[model samples]
Target: MTSLVRSIWGEPEERKLLFKIDFFVLSFVCLQYFSNYLDRANLTNAYVSGMKEALGMTGHDFNNVNSMFTVGYTIAQIPQNLLLQVIPARILFPVNTLIWGCLTMVTAAATHVRHLYVIRFFQGMAEASTFVGAHYIMGSWYKDSELGTRGAIFSSSAQIATIFSGVLQGFIQVPLAVFIVSWLQRPSTKNLDQLHGIAGFRWLFIICGLITVPIAIYGFIFFPDTPETTTAKYFTEEVGLAFILFCVP
Candidate 1:
């Protein structure tokens, strides 16, 4: 089994380094991508679930909010990617993730549709780094043979999050709706409309944000950047040098 695995991957030393890179780099990117999609999916779900009525969203407001997000996303893309040239990926990626997570949480406090517009635009700006940054990091670490599979795995995370979002929203909405209906019928003293002064849709954002922030924190500690400049404790000086030499044409 070990020989077969080594034959498909690389020699023992290379396989050892690859395993570490896969654990630290690939895992972080996939989780970050998953969280990115979760925030986006939650937003659309929130809009349909209750955000429209709660925020008094009028004609074209939702579309405009998405447009604002797109503009911010587009404006930041080049700048963020260029930053990777000077700034370390460990620093840049985690900081960006943290910013977007906070923005996602801030969406819960929005009292007006304009608030959503501002929040989403900045959120987009923060998220602009994730996809391209992941690709760049993967290219830095993986050789041609290994890169394709890792890229596919990373891309699939977004799709998995999309499917999970539907299930998660259903889980959140169904129970809350049923409880509110029961409370309304029973004439309860406590208000069931909002849970602890937060709407269901708002809770969705909060949950997604909560899920995201930890991943950012994890990235800060564990992300290995690239072979040339890695500070990861798991990768020795020799391993980093060997990996760099292997990638050279």
Candidate 2:
């Protein structure tokens, strides 16, 4: 009975302790995604905010902008994936994200139909890299058993981004804007509905752009090239388990 109890209570050799990198990496991925979805859905928010009325856009223009983004997205897809293979993802992903962030902010600057087309085109190219690149990174590093969890996490990120945007615009955007207006001596936002002669939709783009800074910095500073290259704080066993988890899927 004593021997059996000892065996049952013993630690498994394969078990690992928790680590900070685990937390950092997971949070960075999710944060990047939250900003990404917020930026992407800003157009939809703009539509709801009477941006179409302000800009005199018909639903046709909105549809055209979305379609144009899709076309650019399709054309850029394969090359970007290939590029992710050759270029260091650490450098490439952040740069691409920054471009998309700026383009998203510039969406507010659209004065004519052509402005939307141009911004959306570049924004599509910038946006295409991260999703495919992140998936590829997970695939390269994570094992079969770990793949499902990674994929699930990735999917949940997308869902969360969309949900954040929807909930903010649906329930919180106006109230939040009003609060900002009243709270500050020099508000970070002048008026979400109108800023610098641009419609409020553009301001949302700018907000999304700014919001990504911490995450982009995190990726640049912490995302290692490989498991062996990591400088992030983790126990030896934790690092080993991370690779094991990566490969499991």
Candidate 3:
């Protein structure tokens, strides 16, 4: 990054474009990370909102949900990584991300207690690629020392999204309820049932889905698959900085 920064800010105009591309690409990368977290965390938000009562979820059931998610997540890591090699990450990752986002929304539709288990298992499968895959992409492009801050920033989006979910859940509850009324014409009445039933869950899922779709598009449109193959159209200088940062480690 230091190399790219000096090249862009101090070097001749001919070298500046790549550095600019690098900056925009990283910016897109970080923002997708933020949305990635938001989808991952909507479960916690759903729990507090009404998934518990609507589905009669016990502590054991919830624990099992997490447990199943963990198992599925762990099981898929190796295969997912292998799949990365077989697939074009720029295509595979974003398309899969959007699919995961859609799955996240469908989770709100779970009616029986067992439904949560099944959905979470699959969600785990979808999300399984994220950690290892992200690092794989990062390591492919970034040098060791330079990866620290970029990785930190990317990782930190999870924490940021978690904290923000609390506030978002609180504020969106009523508005989401109203949205449910309009979208599905569900329950045909106003009450906790209306606000906390399948319609309500659908609304939350739909919201999470909407937010994730654009990030997936950004990944497809803006983020580079690797330093060797960056395709940023407007900022060549930034791309060079990203290349230099990846090279440092």
Top-lDDT structure, candidate number: 1
What is the total number of backbone clashes in candidate 3?
24
Between candidates 2 and 3, which one is better according to lDDT? Answer: 3
Whole-model alpha-carbon lDDT for candidate 1: 0.84
Report the lDDT tens digits of candidate 2 across residue range 108-130. 66677768888888778777776
Worst 10 residues of 3 by lDDT: 189-198
- At residue 198, candidate 1 shows an lDDT of 67
Give the clash count for each candidate.
0, 15, 24
- What's the ranking of the predictions by lDDT, best on top? 1, 3, 2
Q: Each candidate's root-mean-square deviation in Å?
A: 5.4, 5.9, 5.1
Give each model a TM-score. Answer: 0.87, 0.77, 0.75
- Pitting candidate 1 against candidate 2, the one with the higher TM-score is 1
Q: Pick the candidate with the highest TM-score.
A: 1
lDDT, candidate 3, equals 0.68
| Order of the predicted models by TM-score, top scorer first | 1, 2, 3
lDDT scores for all predictions?
0.84, 0.65, 0.68
